[model samples]
Target: MTRSPATPLPPPKARRRLRETAALTQTQLATRVGVTPGIVRAWESGRTTPRGRKREAYARLLKTLAEEEAARQAKQKQQEQQEQQEQQEHQKPDEKQESAPAPVPKLEPESKPEPQSDAKPAPEPEPEPRPESAPVALTPAQAFDALYAFSAPALVRQTFLLTGRREQARESVERAFQAAWERWPEVARDRDPVGWVRATAYEYALSPWQRFRPRHRHPEPPPADPGDRTLLNTLLRLPPRHRRTLVLYDGVGLDLPETAAETEASTPATANRLLHAREAVAGRLPALADPQVLHRRLTELASNERLRAAEPPAVRRGGERRARLRTRAAIAFTVALIGTTALTARTAPTHYEPPVSPGQAVRGVPHRVAPGALSDEELELRQKLRDQMQDGPERLLPRLE
Candidate 1:
């Protein structure tokens, strides 16, 4: 009997992408392939490969998923093209109407010319200026700079409202922009780039570890105005999450859903936080019970503080510097690790050597003892031998035949 050849599979990354695109879980894929989820995970992570029947099943499944994803993308593209065509079709009449000239007023033959006014006619009004053309597309760096310029100052102010510390706020904004610069492509393509930076800044400003920072351990000076000071103090008193929600919703004028989304909280949770924050503020100052009034006060409080962000170019340079430093540090660490591993491999013993056992006392062997006194019989025999030896010399004459 002959066996059929195994199907070819995509790369690990593509395999994972195919599964995600199909909305299939690792466990589900594992079950279909008759393997454990762990094995499937290992396969997707490029740690292991499947073989025999499982390999063929996984390959076939991925191929189908890829086809489906491609088809979906094609359909979406076609729909977008159709929509664009429809929009152009709708715009044609408006363009024609705008381009057409007005009919000239017809003059009757019986009409008589009215007498000219003696006074100078009113000066003709200047025609309104035409709208400017659409702007040219910006390069990535230019776009990043524009976004930073437009949002940084306002974001610093908003972050100040959240943290009530001008320096911390500035630092947070700088860090967020640095991160955005590091991921400029992603941020630029995001639907709301401002929101992305805002969220990052908020997260940095509200991080619990900030308290451990030596610079942040001390409190910053309050705003100059008593009202501003009081408002700032009240805002600082709220929990970080609530404070963030309040600032996003009231200070920045974001809508409830947007605030919730930015804060990563449910709408109801965000509303509750906002309500609690407002109640706390109003309790401290009776005048801020109204949302509009609270918003105005928050804005006024933030604006009253003097906070500045680093220049965009400086921020971008800083981000790049940080990235290079991190990369270098990682390389150093990896080199050290590899060196240590190689050293160990070179110096390690090749064969096992059994350990030597410790010495133990023998069971039956008698220990040596010092001789004390010779017995009397042994002493007498020694004396007799001394006397007999002297006589044995006379008796030692040669014996004749």
Candidate 2:
């Protein structure tokens, strides 16, 4: 498989937010992330993304953000609870003191009640409150480890494929983490933060760049041996909605219904796009080869490690930043390819058959065939013809019998 040229993952704005929140200058964050202050500004402003090992550094920074946010929330909650408990305790003593002297008067035993057949029994007493445990905060290191472990390279790869640019995917992923970190206290409670991040990243990946930024060009078909390059190219030529349907249905192993949900498209629309995409692929494939076979082969190739080998860097450098950049670039490349392929398939001609044949008689009009289904004119013509023939044909035949 021919590796496409890699692009650098661009920097994101989270750094600026972090700095502002921390009341620190760009120099401060740069010092922490081990980059020049200028680099910090560039990243914050979307000028460029950090490369290779720098991603780990960035991840670490995000972890710090999560930890700090978590700590702040935990402290606030603890303070609130403590204050409420203290207020209650202070009020309890006063109430008890006032009531202490008002003991119940001694009284004679009451007469026993007669047995009742229909009375319902009362419910049992409520359980006592269990001792509450101390709030445990996730350390920055622990949070970083979790994020690192849960971070799937595949998502980045997919994003890269969609955008045909590396930095964009990295920024998207970083933004996802930044969002999560900003609300870490709430997000951490979720059973699947990784899943949430993945979903968010994909959403970001799907979104187009703002009008100011360069619009993405459709991805070119990858070389064959990786599959039918022409078919892939055709698939890439489709509209985004249709292309997504095709990818989710074929590339991502999603059924029609699932693909519909994933793409947020109606079932009929999804089905139509998928059908068209398949037809386009079929049209482009070798006559002897089945479209299904080609689709499966392409899917396999996409998933293959050999095909997925990280492309060589346009400018090689030794370090963590470079590595992160490479990973992001690879991811972006993959996503662009998948999204483009799906889009392409949707727009291409599908060889759809006509629903109606020319000269077919229609009800209510003359027998002239319409471009679409029988036009009103044809319908009327047909009705007139039917009425004319209603009387026995012998009525119009010559009397010479």
Best by lDDT: 1
Q: What TM-score does prediction 2 earn?
A: 0.34
- How would you encode candidate 2's per-residue C-alpha lDDT over 1-401 as one tens digit per residue? 99544333322434455556666766677788888876765555442457667766866776677578779889999999999999988876544334356678999999999979998898999999999998898874467446744564555555544443456656666666655655556456554466556556667766755324653444333554544444445655776666666665666566764455445444577889877877776666654146467556655544442222122121111223555777899999999999999999999888987688566666898765657788799999989897796655565655775
User: Can you give the TM-score per candidate against the true fold?
Assistant: 0.60, 0.34
lDDT of each candidate versus the true structure: 0.83, 0.59
Stretches of candidate 1 off by over 4 Å are: 1-134, 357-401
Cα deviation in Å at residue 198, candidate 2?
3.8
Off by over 4 Å in 2: 1-151, 185-195, 210-232, 255-257, 286-295, 298-401
lDDT of 1 at 257: 59
For every candidate structure, what is the RMSD over all alpha carbons to the true structure, in angstroms? 15.2, 32.4
Tens-digit per-residue lDDT, 1-401, candidate 1: 99886687786657766887798877798898889877886676443568887888888888889999999999999999999999989877654434678799997789777878787788999999999999999988888899999999999998888888888889899998999888887667565778878888888989999889998667777788888888888888999888888888888888885675566544578899999988898899999999889888887877777788889999999999999999999999999999999999999999999999997779898776898788999999989887786644455667799
lDDT of 1 at 125: 100
